[model samples]
Target: MLFTDLARSLPATIPFVGPEALERRMGVKFRARLGANESVFGPSPMVLEAMAEAARESWAYGDPEQYELKRAIADHHGIGMENIAIGEGIDGLLGHLVHLAAVPGDRVVTSYGAYPTFNYHVAGHGARLDFVPYRADDHEDPEALAARARDVRPKLLYFANPDNPTGSVHDAATIGRLIDAVPEETILVLDEAYSDLAPDGSLPPISLMRPNLLRFRTFSKAYGMAGVRVAYVVGEPAAIAQFDKVRNHFGVSRMAQAGALAALADQDHLRATIIRIAHAREELAAIARRANMTPLPSATNFVAIDCGGNGDYARTLLAAVLKRGVFIRMPGVEPLDRMIRVSVGTPDDLALFEDALMGAIAEVGRPTAT
Candidate 1:
């Protein structure tokens, strides 16, 4: 085979199977697309206009420097333009970081059952991964991760604030301690993908920069441009420069840049979207309560509702929900997997999910005592 040894050794996999694939497999169109945590509310009007205008200029490749968008982002965060590196999304930037930092056999550390995509990138590079388990409260345990990183001195340590799967978050002080604790040799890959939706005080200051820490934020969430695929990493200028060595210069499209620029300019639209997501999140929690499942406290746009059972019960309920034309997701590993994750959606979308949840419970029934 022409493939490299590293490529050959890695399994063919994606971070998550998208809802389209599920719709095809199940032979039913999802009446409500609540899975995958996409912003069902869509992007701002100005973003649509900007992207539309840029579409006519699509024949030209996006500027490799991405100067305007980077400048806008830097100004927005009160950081210098040198501190930014743009990419397809946080996922793509992460891949570049892994390639830039970790060679074969280098160690990387992340929480078990955190963002699987980061783990996928680590595996692709043939780096060894050491996992620290999530806390009993379902939050990623920063102190535990810090201890492990100190011991292993891994090339990269991945931590997501307002984390995926469980939608849990720690205060800025706790995150600040974790940031300080990371070993000098290790690059702290701080993923703040859901930062726009995060409650006040859940994020550190944008001006905070460390040579070994890179913070990733995206237009995909509150900006409602997931399909546009634009995200950037913020760090000290020297640390951010390394991404240029491995990133595809033109990977972020012209339309994406235009859309994200407009999205950033329109703070009103972003704030309104956040409010809508919060309301939807509350409705989702209420739906969970109506069905007797416990909704985990969330600072992001989704809720992880405890099914009050084991992984098996959650999986069964998820499958039933899918069968009923409502799409949702769950964590794949133990303990965390006992909850179903439903993204914030429209009133009609939540209505579909509520109906589906009740029916799924009726079909699968609840878990009995051991």
Candidate 2:
């Protein structure tokens, strides 16, 4: 048996290591798990109840069209049902978009340190990725990205507002300008996975007026439905229709649709969760300050702490936290990689982080060769 040439050439590493894998390796459960931007606050009571109710019907396959979820999303966003497409999550939708736009050797443009999942999709589709370095003063510079897209003439341009790793965001006006600057034929894939966690006015208004813009939102973050694997894309009807050609129809489970629908309906829970996340972010920043680290202002559920040194120092701090049974992550690229990213969690979790971080610094501060 033989694998495809693409699969053979691709690296064998999984882009992200789940917490379960870390537990397996360490042979202990994490004391304060906050690496993945999951909502520790958990999904709404209504969402859980809906899932439980749907579970009884698990023997049947999910609606291949995902009609109910799509319709609900469309109503919420004030868009037509045809303008929506649901999938296993934004990850799956991204893969389908990459395949639809980029043939092998086609170019794809993205920020150098943007979401890795989008880059992974580009690689999987054999697209050549042209990366623009993030703006030195701003991590989420849509203008810089627009310049890169214009220069590269990529078939797909990826942007993640309230970016991962850095937790930075671009204002709606800036995003609009970037959209305007893109070539008419270029596909702009905006991953708004963190948009729900972002403050009001942070995201662009829900409008499918652009032929090239595709916006993806997920239940994985603020909704606390990462395990549910439900996400949806909003775009022009014609643009969204392309997804039907490549998506795994029954990929989204019935439980996912039911749960997500219930989650959407429960605005109160979502509001409360967002409030808690905001406070946690502030608390984490305060902790970073006490530890002599700088916490970058974040609009997402995670805070990126400037370790005040190079990547090596950040890595040391991260390892120290992990050893202390606190799971966290950092940027994988240079410069940005100097900051350790910690997701917002419950007060108890933040307390654990503060203790672990202080201990780690103290341990690493021991006298050594100067």
lDDT of each: 0.93, 0.88
Window of ten residues with lowest summed lDDT in model 2: 361-370
Q: Among these predicted structures, which one has the highest lDDT?
A: 1
Query: Against the true structure, what is each candidate's TM-score?
Result: 0.99, 0.97
TM-score of 2: 0.97
Q: How close to the true structure is residue 73 of candidate 1, measured as C-alpha lDDT?
A: 96
lDDT of 1 by residue, 1-370 (tens): 7999999988999789998999898898999988888899899999999999999999999899999999999899999999999999999999999999999999999999999999999999999999999999999999999999999999999999989989999999999999999999999999999999888999999898899989999999888998899999999999999998888998999999999999999999999999999999999999999999999988888999999999998999999999999999999999899999999999999999999999999999987764
Model 2 misplacement above 4 A = 366-370
